[model samples]
Target: MKTVVITGAASGMGLSATKLFLAKGWKVMMADFNQEAGKKTADELATRYSKKQVAFHKTNVADSSSVKELKNATAKFFGVADSIINNAGIFTKGALHEVSEENWDRIMAVDVKSIYLMTKYFVPDMIKQKAGTIVNTASISGLTGDYNMAAYNAAKGAVVNLVRAMA
Candidate 1:
């Protein structure tokens, strides 16, 4: 079975995608910041599928160290991921004046920089194997400005450009 790694796998798009991949018979490594939720989801999947088909790794996608550890653990568990879904993200709703520096930085780090970090650690394995795919989840707000969500718009806009550049 192909191995897939998904970040923010605890909920929303990430969670939905995880279920879809598992249903398709792919081995999945569910990575998320919420240890409890991540483990819970993994346990449920294990019960439905085989325990061997699912695993959870707690990760802070924005942190280089955490992401590196995720890479190491995933490699140990299932070898290099055949596909990586860089889907971890946060949304902040506010105009520029109302947005804090901390919020802006947080959103940018998680939504934008995580892609670079994931690719940095995972792409080499893909290159060695001569195959791989990277799917980046960007918001429609990234393509056009959204009301009262300046930081989100900015960060996701960067995501769009980054994906374009990667392509």
Candidate 2:
């Protein structure tokens, strides 16, 4: 069976992808920062898809060590992942003067740096196998500016271009 790592898999697009991958007969490692939600979702999915097909790992995508740990866990649980969906993201909107520096940094870290971290940690196995896929979820906000959302727009914009560069 194919293996996949999907960040933010507790909800939203990540959750949807988890379900779809399970339906397609792929083993899924569901990574999320929300431990309770992540565990609950994993348990429910396991009931539907069997425990062997679904597992959960709590992850903070903004942290390098956390991402590395996720990679380690994936390898231990299901061998090399055939794909990773970098779907974890947070949205914050504020005027340039109103946005805190910390908020700006967080936006960049979670939205952009997470992709870099995941690629750094997981792509090596793909290279060794001569096959892999990376899916970075970017928004229309990335292509167009938003009012009071400079930080979010900038981060997503970086993700957009980074996806291009990776391609």
Candidate 3:
């Protein structure tokens, strides 16, 4: 069976994708920073679809090492991943000049750096296998600037362009 690895798989769009994939008979490796939510989601999915079909790994997408570890764990659990969805991100809104450095960094780390880290570790395996797909989530705010959301807009804009560049 084909396997999919999805970052931020514990909730929102990621969680919805997980459910859809499971319903479609795909093996899913759910990665999220929220241990409780991740574990709960995994347990529920496993119960619904059998343990062999669903698994969860707690991962901090902003950390390169964490992302590498997640890739390794997924490989060990289900062999190389057939696809990856870089769906993890954070939205922090503030005026461009008013945003704190810490908040800006956090947004950038989660929204932009997460993709870099995941692709850094997972893309190589995909390339070696000679077939795989990557999907990244970006918001409409990225395409058009929004008021009082400069940081989020900037980070999402980067993601949108990055996705195009990857394609």
Top candidate by lDDT: 2
The C-alpha TM-scores of every prediction are 0.98, 0.98, 0.98
Q: What is the lDDT for 53 in model 2?
A: 91
Q: Please provide, for model 1 over 104-131, each residue's C-alpha lDDT reduced to its tens digit, 9 standing for 90 to 100.
A: 8999999999999999999999999999
Cα lDDT, model 2, residue 29? 99
For model 2, what is the error of residue 29's alpha carbon versus the real structure, in angstroms, after optimal superposition?
Answer: 0.4
In angstroms, the error of model 1 at 162 is 0.4
Worst 10 residues of 2 by lDDT: 92-101
The residue ranges of model 2 lying beyond 4 angstroms of the native Cα positions read none
The RMSD of every model to the true structure, in order and in angstroms, is 0.7, 0.6, 0.7
> In candidate 1, which residue ranges exceed 4 Å CA deviation?
none
Residue lDDT tens for model 2, 1-167: 99999999999999999999999999999999999999998999999989999999999999999999999999999999999999999999888788899999888999999999999999999999999999999999999999988888899899999988999
